[model samples]
Target: FRKVVHIEQGGLVKPERDDTEFQHPCFLRGQEQLLENIKRKVTSVSTLKSEDIKIRQDSVTKLLTDVQLMKGKQECMDSKLLAMKHSFSS
Candidate 1:
């Protein structure tokens, strides 16, 4: 997320806020990490380590869920910022 505050003469004017894109590089990196974790989970299962497989799967699920939530929030914020910009520009 990015925040822009407009100020003049050492006083506050207005604050403009924006959120980064959901599909930005940072979000993609999280996806990549989740994929890597899945791969590890598969390898663990293949090695007959059921407990390790379960743990890895749980971790991967949590991470993916987190990423999804963050992306959703970012998109929402972006939309709100766009609306605010439109309103201010009008």
Candidate 2:
């Protein structure tokens, strides 16, 4: 009689195979290590992407503030030029 293997998934246990060859210790360890490595890589990439987006947002906000400051300076300069012109014309 062959050994039976029951695979549990999603709260359900189902018989998968009748062979014992799939229960190798080295193979299981390698699979576990591969899954862990994949998880780490995914987490690293996700964090990098999130930080990149935040950096871009901060750059955009700084640029907007710089533009507003330039506009204010331009308005002040225009008012000063107009006052000078009026005094010179008089």
Candidate 2 residues 1-90, lDDT tens each?
Answer: 223344443224543543343333333454766443332113555567787889999999999999999999999999999999999999
- In order of appearance, the predictions have TM-scores of 0.47, 0.47
Q: Which window of 10 residues has the lowest lDDT sum in candidate 1?
A: 18-27
Error of 1 at 2 (Å): 56
- The TM-score that candidate 1 achieves is 0.47
User: Per-residue lDDT of 6-87 in model 1, one digit per residue for the tens?
Assistant: 3432235332443322222233554666444332113443676889778989999999999999999999999999999999
Per-residue error for 78 in candidate 1, Å, reads 0.4
At residue 36, give the lDDT of candidate 1.
40
lDDT of 1: 0.63
Give the Cα lDDT of each candidate.
Answer: 0.63, 0.65
